[model samples]
Every structure is written in structure tokens, then in C-alpha cells.
Target: MGLSKRRAHLRKAWFKKGCVSPKKGQTVAFPTVADNEFVRFEKKSFDRRVHTSNNVLTFKDTDGTDTTVSALRPRPNASNVVDEYSGCGDESLYPDLCTNKLMVQAKVQALFYSSFKEHRQDKPNCEGDLNFDAAYSIKWGLGWRELLKCTKCSCMCDYHNLYEEVENKKRSG
Candidate 1:
């Protein structure tokens, strides 16, 4: 069977099993509350309580306007892309500790390809001829490690080895 047909079959099965369903056409009705009551609940839920030590300050901009900053809301536990450096930048620094070695290697290979493309584009051609030195530099050792380290956080891990392990797993799997 083709991929699309298989997907459609799976979707139908999912709906039949109550795992998936279309949204109801009917509109949902919500209960209306008084402004005062809403304000009270909003204060309790979002701002907590106002105390001398824990009280949050509200201020207006330069143009004499009152403004209030909402308290930080709790986030749901969901998978998200985090960069290297544990926050942003090179993936080598903040390795995806959650992911298996195979996944990490795949990511590194993708990175290598992207970097190689950029390196090729940056070099000037020798009068319509390709720059052999620049090509060699990119193919042999583009200093990807040093570049990654400088841009990413300081983590004492061999990313090349990690990539190799992941690649091996990918091949086997």
C-alpha cells in the first residue's frame, strides 16, 4: 500500500477506536460572572496575594499611563527544541541528554552538511575556478569543533564520537 493510503486507513481506524474525532459543530456556552467577581478570581489566580514582602509593583510608562505586569504562568511539560549552551547556540554544549546517542549523531551530521554548504558559499572562486585550498579546508577540517565550542557552552564532551555512535545506531536500526 502507498503511504497516503496507509495513513488514511490508520486515521479511520483511530476514529473508529475513539482515539480521534472531529470537533462538534455546536458552540460551547460559558457561564458569565460579575466584573467584581472576575477581578477577585483573577487577582487570586494570577497575582497570588498582595503582601509587603511579596507585593508586586505596578507602574506607568513615561506618558502617565497605569500598567500592570502579570505574574509568570506555570508551563506545561512538553518537548521543546533547546540549543547548545543549555539554552541557545551549539548543540554540542548542551547535548540533548534526553535523546539516545543515535539521535544526537543524526543531528550532528545534519549540522556538518549545513556548515559545509555555508563554507563553500563564503569562499571566493579563483577567476571562475574553484578555490582548492578553501575546498580542502572545508572537506578536511573546517574547525567545526572550535567553531561549535566558541559559539556553544563549554562542555567537555566529544561530539564527533557521539555523532559516530548515533550514526551507527541509525544504520543498525
Candidate 2:
């Protein structure tokens, strides 16, 4: 019928056959009542006990599936113990709780630089009739003017005047 009923029936049968003995604290043991049997009686003896405390037991059945049993009672004072363990007033332990701060920071920095370049590229044309031509002028080296000239007009102009003219054209346009 049910698991408890089946276990009780097995216990009664074992006890009646002198195959088990009852002990204190919900224990049952197989004890040797007589000798001269071929089975090596002492080696085959074993004990079975029922747990009365809050513990989890995992068992596997013959079909290879697992069964888990847990206590039904709730632990007393668990929240109070947890609160005491984590201090009543502490903020330093929480440190913002980001999972990957360095990776996020690097991604944000990369986004900022990418957006800055995009904004510079998207600015409207400003230089109106300046024949700003230079192959590799030292004055216009590695500046926004050089970049804009290389990108837009295909000619490099004076760095200072190119920056001012670009800004002025951006504002006007």
C-alpha cells in the first residue's frame, strides 16, 4: 500500500523471524541469535534507523531515478541569525555589486571615443575657398585639421586656421 505501511510490515516480519532486534533511539539491528549457519551471520548483520531531525536524504531506485526527501519543519531563528551575521549597519561590504566593472569601464571608454570620432566626422563642412594643400606639413601634423583635410578635401591646410575655419563653418552650417 503506502511506504510507511510497507516498511512497518517488513519490520514486523524481520523481528518475528529473529533476524532483527530493536534498539533505543529508533534503531534496528540484525543480531545473531544462534550459530552454525553457513551464511557467516555476524558479517551479514546491519542496522536501519529513522531520522527525526532536519536533514535531506537522497536515494536512488532500481530504475535509476533519484528521490530526495527533506524535513518538513522550518528552522527557528534563521532570519535573526542571518541578520546578526551580516551586521545591522554596514554599507562598505556592498561596493555597488557590479559583476564586471573593468570590462564595463573599458566598453564605456571605447563607446565615448567612438562617439567623439563620429561627432567630429558628422560636423558640417566649414572651409569655404581656402586652397589648403600640404602633403606632410610639420605644422598640420596629426591634428583634427589634418584629419579633416585628409578625409574631406584630400589636402592639408595650416593646422590653426583649419581648426578655426572648421569650427566657424560648423557653427554657420
Best by lDDT: 1
- For residues 42-71, what per-residue lDDT tens digits would candidate 1 score against the true structure? 333333332234574443333546434333
RMSD of each: 28.1, 25.2
Q: Which candidate is the best by TM-score?
A: 2
Report the lDDT tens digits of candidate 2 across residue range 80-128: 5755655535454232231112223443344345434543465536333
Spell out the clash pairs found in candidate 2: none
For each candidate, what is the lDDT?
0.37, 0.36
Deviating ranges (above 4 Å) for candidate 1:
1-44, 47-102, 123-173
Model 1 backbone overlap count:
2
